[model samples]
Target chain A: MEKLNKDVWVFVEQRDGKPADVSFELLSKGRKLAKNLNGNLKSVVIGHDVLALAEETFRFGAVEAIVVDHKELGHYRTMPYSRIINQLIEKEKPRVMLFGATIIGRDLAPRVASYTKSGLTADCTDLQVSDVQYLRKDYKDLLLQIRPAFGGNIIATIISPDVQTQMATVREGVMRMEPLEKHVKGKIRNIEYTPDPVDELVKLIEQHRQENKVNLKAAPIIVAGGYGMRTKANFELIRELADLLGGEVAGTRAAVDAGFINHDRQVGQTGVTVRPKLYIACAISGAIQHRAGMQEANKIIAINSDPEAPIFGVAHYGIVGDAIEIIPRFINVFKQKLR
Target chain B: MQRCVQTGALNQSIILRIKKAAMGFNSIVMVKQVPDTANISGQVMKEDGTVNRAKLPAIFNHEDRVAIELALQIKDKFGGKVTAITMGPPRASDILRECLYMGADEAYLISDRKFAGADTLATSYVLSEAIKKIGGYDFVFAGRQAIDGDTAQVGPQTAEKLHIPQITYSEEILGIKDGSVQIKRKIDGGFEVLESKLPLLVTVIKDAVSPRPFKARRVMAYKNARTLLELEKLTEGNSLLYIDQLKDDYVNKGLYIHTLTMDDLKLDESRCGVHGSPTKVHKVESVVLAGGSHEMIEPTKEGISRLIDQLLEDHILG
Candidate 1:
């Protein structure tokens, strides 16, 4: 396995002919890594009728797009997907591989690593290229995999030294997507997938994707609550503010544990990561777990009764008052101004 | 003294015997003693960004306790034994004792000076080796993620090392029938039910079920349970405490916590600790949020209007 011939590969995940946001983010980041190592950036697209998505990878920054289109690949089934990926790695021998830390990726990456006898760092928050010296050995141009460990208490930087390929899965909303370059052309290579017998072991009977009216990812404004809300009924303030702003309501793990909001609305380490343009935190003390998810918001406004609350530390604007009283008045002013 | 019975009665007894024999499910629960991250202070973070674990008090991982409770529940439903295992320093025996108080039949501590400073990959390698040595287990249960590492990778990695299937983020065990188990797992929005065969690894979440309180009787009985290291310390400089006699007594009373070392497991020294971990700390910065000229808006109607005006001026609102 010669490292000189290998290129950087990003797994472009798509559903219903639309690429996931993280796929584009990976391509943007992969472009930098490939350039730093002086290698070609390739996008691997696998699904049914995803030719448009294969071509779309070029705009994000892929120098070449590899498509493995198959009818059985429409819905993500673990066995078939892992087998195909493992075979590709065995053949092309990529120097670096990236996947989104999504449900499908999380399930598939470990299996592929096991098949290829490689090391993988999961749910990474950051990736960089660096020269590493360990145990009296020099590893140049190594991909640094950075992630929060110990429940967000510390960060760990991982590298794969001995393996032919280095793999990592980046969490959503961590990396900013690079602006698309128009009129950029890239090579497209299509491959036919032949399924092995083991792929038939598991069958996808049905998939139920709940209709989410509050799209946190696409929401530009988010009014989030925390444990200070006290009760489920008190969440009405968050809902009212979000409704007024035409945004979505989110909560921390504490609020979810208290049943103030559904798990889907959780904005923290173990939940959905959101990077809204404006984040209004109502009586929410910012724990590191919650901050890791939303620290990238363009602007933050924290309102709390305690002036010393941690949320105020990260907020661009701090309001030291009770949310119960302030939110109502703020809503009235906004309504009048809009009128 | 054989008594003749009807054909239907004979068939019923045979079915019962077969069911009893086949349904016996033994479980091994992997637990860890982690530094309480919630109560971290300034000194908890070392200069190298690694945790100064000695500065923080250690506690049994909360989710691991739930894993033990689930294992015990499975044992209660089907007649089998439950063993708790952990890989840490000798003092980790404290968690093993807590596992006993929570109804574990036995406990083992995989401890050695060489096993220190292990990342998720090395830790899972050692744990998988210990599991393989322990042998006959229908299921291996673990927490979804340890609070300390919070990687949520060890359980799946250990399963991969052992060449077994894994179900993670498990919330409930529906049942076990015909050598297959049904599990309810938490997904993004809702939960899904999955069915897998025996010899599977399941990582449980905090929302699975509330762990049961320690039994008072069991606590009183296992309070003095000690590993070999602690026993050696007890006999050190104290002529009254003889090591062999104390060990025999503890073993007879079922209070001895089994301890294993690298030599016992025959593990490769190269793949045991920091040497095996590929992760290196390139840099760590302590993030201290400094409020940059934050304004304290008064809790008044005029103040609310001023805040709205400022937001609009800043283009935060329309």
Candidate 2:
């Protein structure tokens, strides 16, 4: 397939009819990339009926949208999505394909790339266009894929050689979502795909949402407990602070392992990356892994008995008081403020 | 903070295989031979200032293979397949063949010049793609952290990229039933039992399971699976027919040397490589230690008085 098309493609991720939040985020990023490349941003929406959201996607900046609407593609199985995306690349041959580095994107991106025999940059933190490659003649692309390297210490630059259409899977909230403006013009091309069951070796088992739905990323204000919380009962301090502020409770790796909070509520390299508005950390030593997840919050308030706890380094405000004693005070102040 | 550890002693946590079982559950262990970050030599970086990756001796991350072994033990309990996925330089293929010898069905090397210096975000992006390409899986497991970087970010971030609910820092898989996965995660001091749905990504900490020793025969049989570059080297000197036959034979034999480049993922050239990265190394400096003097104190008041006087003389205290 020739890479002649001069438009940008964002995988419009949808499940059960609604678009994933990351889709809007990617569309926001893709619009900028398309503008820089002097091209149009497009959407590859797949599902039973998602053409309706095509205009909404374009309103978010897509110039053209590609819809691979089909019933077999209703539930996202690896094989069908891969087949459809793979077929779209061959037929349309867009200059770029960016996906929300979500579960489906992670599952779908590589299979499509492998089928096309191209390189894929996963979980991209930044995106841009550049003239870079290891080999001059064969491996050169005009677009640049930016990502974090060395475990978020250094930013590594990756350039695809010769593949006109490059693929990258980006994580949620790495880039801010821009609001949709006026209605944008676009066309939706529907493609047909049928993958054999023998081709799909893995069956779709049922997916269950955790009973204690603690989504760390989406939570507004987070009260994070650390090992300093000591016993399980002490964790109530974290919950009380969160409840008083109309927020959610999170934990440092220490508190979570101490059996205080669910693993989903963990904030760090092994946990969730949350950029809440307020992060109140109690007795949590600032390990790099723990810091990675919650450091992005708009404001951080550290409450540790030890004045020198590492959490103080990045906190917007620091309090050298026992979380046990201080949490009650904080709850009182929060209650008064709310009233 | 370093925890005092006895290296070879097995934690009492690992549960070995029970009676007769169908060949065990299929398990794929992910391992990375990262640079030993602890040993920073006196010599500063080179002229261009890249912290010499060559001088850094690689160590199999202590936590990652434990994740792999946990999976292997799970496969031992339930009958199934374990396939390992690694995205790195050609030398990383060394670890993939090692995964095979340890007990993986087949391993794929997702190597490309394009992926040379990717960060965790990009690295997980590439691996997620490879996992997606690999197709079938009820579970995707990774080590808690790579020691060299000490950034345990990859595993959970990869799970997020895959858009699956992840159970990280697992010390053991206590139970795996119809739809839920119950596992023991290493919290700060103890452990927590977490139950999440199927198709979840788990990052295993050290002691998640006892790592099975490398099996000698499987290692010998599968050691010849050349990475893309290695295969290219062999084909360079061979008879046209022999090279063609060898390449086709490896593919048919299922020795996955799946190679993809820029054209594969259809990534925008602008968003990948170094240029796409907005973060830059503002600076790196040596951290100094300043508390290394000797102090003598006796039980008596006179001795204590002398110590206090010395501290006062040094302006350490009033």
Candidate 3:
């Protein structure tokens, strides 16, 4: 039997030039997984002239970088991107691979997984390297993919024990991003992109990208609402409070689905993970999926009518009352104090 | 690949067809009936680490209905046929009928006990097989991900099995000109306009387009459409209505939802179901948010004022 490689590889997703925050977050998490498996942490950077970004991975504890720089690979085209990653995965045979569950990552990872015939899981919240016994078969050094399933009602630990290569797409903000204090010199392996005729099946004609106006991550305070806001009209109280307090307004997935907020303002496992200095959750039940994104805030205050709302578990201060009624009073108090 | 220079804006139905290599498009939309994950109860999961779907009510995945809407739009624009298919239990036929009500020209149910317990990979293999059996399709469509699994793997995986290019996260179909289809797809903080050759697969996002409401007339037409398995169940222990005769009658009226099984698709037994799934659920833990110490505040104005004061004292607010 061929020996399984223990190297942990993170697909460094980038657009234009700057790499995604989730890619760096995965690199930081991959560092620990690689250490547990007794191997090196490698970053696969693919984009036009993205060679410079390879060094950035080292700051996040990557020991090696595999750069596939090509003009065709500048923006993420599914065929070419997946083709390049599949070739590298087939050649390197890394034990574990991680992708940030961004649009580009979700688009590229599954195709590569199909081409490589490896087991791939999506939107994983946590990943760990552990030994596992499955179906009466002992497996050593497997990647345990932990994720919230069934709308975050349950947490399932999934493992690809039989497959040599285990891949997972992790949502952003689920993992802590910690750069190493000590920098290690990393090796750069540049792989040539051999374009194929099939790669031209899809051609990018035009692209329209606007700078995201909502910077929830950088905000010091976030006032988020949930389904309990009742109606789109009632959801305005959350926005009004946020406006009065000079903070950003966010929402749970339900609120987004209910059209109370934009997808960009959504906060949860499937949306952006934010660590504001203060998080004020209003009318949000605080499901584990939603908590996975905001529980890391410096201070949490939950306002819910349900006394047993799960959001209270993580809140520093729990207010069991109607947000619609309490928010106006809270606003009046703040207005008087600030005045 | 077909390429033709655009002639100044002319009637698309007449002039565009004259320049195009292919006259019409045939699309297959994949639909799924998933458990309502939002209304989950404590009994949602069984003891074996799998979801007790029987305990939960099933509904057509919202995004999938959006996919069907996109396909139906293509059919209306380009003079094509839309076929909706699902791989699930017999009860999944409900969604297929719903597909017909939404303007699908035909519907298929790919169900078998042998296909049970399949993960994304195994499920995609079976779907790919069924797609091949229903060949001559220019486009394959599905939702980005089903709410129940939220894996979003089956669309791309099935596309790979069909050996075609895919455009996931599609927002709208720009146009199909000179035998190539233009699509506007969503990316991080932006959108891209891409053109792909025929026989492509696209997975749609919820924001793509509002699914058309089921037409009342179409609903009246297809409300009684039943699959062969459904007919078998209806005729079970009823001597008068022979299953075969009833199926033929339904097929003649075009009210029979085509049903395919493992034997019909000739799928490899090993790769059809749970055996083909490489990923296994090792453990399922009910979400128990770790209890932490917290202060309960009164809902009165005085209590709110006191909380505000504490925030200022802690420098969380000023």
Candidate 4:
């Protein structure tokens, strides 16, 4: 049997030249996974003129940077991107590869996985390396992909024990993005792009990507609502409270589904995870999936009519009352106290 | 790249048909009957961590239903046949009928016990083989992800197995012209328009289009549509009916939802199910959240005032 390469690789997804924040997060996570496997952490940066982006990976704890530069790869075209990554993986045989579960990552990962004939899991919230025994066979140092399945009711630990290269597309913000205290001068191995005619089959007609209007991940305070807000009118109270506190307004997936909030403003497992300084949960019966995203906040205040609501579990302060009424009182109290 | 090598010969025919705007495209849609995860209740997760699917009502996956709507809309605009296929137990024919009601011309059920415990890899293998066996398809459509597993890999994986290009998270069909189809797909913050040649796959998101309501006439016509296994069950309970005769009648009348087993697709036994899967479930844990001590606040004015004062002192707020 060919020995499995222990190197951990993070696909440093980039748009234009700037790299995605999730790529840095994966580098931070890949650092830990590399340490566990006693291997080097490498960043696979692909784009036109993304050498600086490749260098940036070292600041995020990568030991080496593999750069693939080409004009056709300036933007993320699925065909070219997947082919480049597939070629690298096939040659390197890295033990574990990670990609952010962003739109581009989701599109490219599976195609690459299938083309390489490797195992891939999607939207994983947590990843770890451990030995596993499956079907009366023992496997060493497998990537345990932990994710909430069946609408976040249960968590399943999935492992690709039989495959040489295990891959996963992790949800953004689930892993913390931490730069090293001192940036390491990592080795850069530049690779050539061998263009194929198939890359031209799908033509990029037009692209319109605006900066996200809601920067919930960077907000210091978040006021989030849930389905219990009753109507879209009542849900506006959450926005009022967030405004009074100079914070961002967010909501649960159910609230988003109910049309009280937009999907972009959603904060949960299926949505973006947030670690605001304070999270004010209004009428949210915190499902485990919801908490997986926001429970890490420094201080949490939950307001719900039901005292037994699960949101109170992680709340520093819990108020058992109707949010429609109590939120108005909260707004009034803040106004009077600030005055 | 091997798939791309054949694109040269394929492109010649595709280009030759560019002028025929009225000619419709042949489309195949992949659909699934998933457990209603949105309304989960009452011991749905067994002690062993496997889902007690019996407790949850099975329904057509919303995104997949949307994919069917898109496919039907394509067929309506361009003239073509729409076929829907699913791989599940015999009971999964329920969703296939729903597909027929929603305007699919034909439906197929690929079911067998040997396919049990299949992960995404094995599942995609079976589906790809089924699609190939059906053949003559210009487009393959699937939902972005299913509600049950939330793994969106099957569509793209199947596309890869079929050796075709795939455009995922599609929101709208921009246009189909000059031997290529244009699509508007969702990205992180906005959208992108991409154009790909015919004989590709598209995975749709929920916001793509609202699934059309089942037509009254179509429902009346296809409500009794049954797969072979269903017909066998009916005949087993009745002494008067002959299985072969009933099947022939159903097929003749176009009421027989086509059925395929592993043997029918000629799939490698090892690759049809769990044995061919590379990934395995190491552990399943029902989420149990432990609540620690917390301070309860009064709903009165004084309570609200004190909470504000505490926030000011803690510097969490000014």
TM-score of every candidate relative to the true structure: 0.87, 0.58, 0.95, 0.95
lDDT of 2 by residue, A101-204 (tens): 66566556655665554556666656887544343343323566655444333345666655557777776666667857676776776666565653343334
Model 3 chain A scores worst on lDDT over the 10 consecutive residues at: A108-117
**TM-score of model 4's chain A:** 0.97
Q: Predictions ranked by TM-score, top down?
A: 4, 3, 1, 2
Complex DockQ per candidate: 0.31, 0.04, 0.66, 0.64
> Candidate 4 chain B: minimum summed lDDT over ten consecutive residues — where?
B14-23
State the lDDT of candidate 3 residue by residue for A1-339, as single tens digits. 877799999999988888889998999999999999998899999999887799889899888999999888888898888888888888889999999998888888888888787889999988998989888989888899999888787899999887778999998777888998986799899898898998999999999888889888889999999999999998899989888878999999999989999999999998889998899999999988899999999999999999888999899999999998999999999999988
User: Can you give the lDDT of residue A145 in candidate 3?
Assistant: 95
Tens-digit lDDT track of model 1 for A1-339: 534645899998875556778888888899899988888899999999988889888988787889899999997666677778889999888989999877667766766776675668887777898888866899888888887665456666777877778888887666778957483689899888998765654434334565446578889899999999888888899999999998899999889978999877888766768888899999797876788788778888888998877688778878888888888888898898889
**What's the C-alpha lDDT at position B105 in model 1?**
93
Pick by TM-score: which candidate is best? 4
Cα RMSD to native, each candidate? 4.3, 15.2, 4.0, 4.2
The true-versus-predicted C-alpha distance at residue A77 of model 2, in Å, is 1.0
Model 4 stretches with alpha carbons more than 4 Å out: B1-23, B47-50
Cα lDDT tens digits for candidate 4, A85-136: 8888888899999999998888888888888878888888899988888878
Task: Give the range of the ten consecutive residues with the poorest summed lDDT in model 2 chain A.
Answer: A203-212
Error of 2 at B144 (Å): 11
What is candidate 1's TM-score against the reference?
0.87
lDDT at position B45, candidate 4: 74
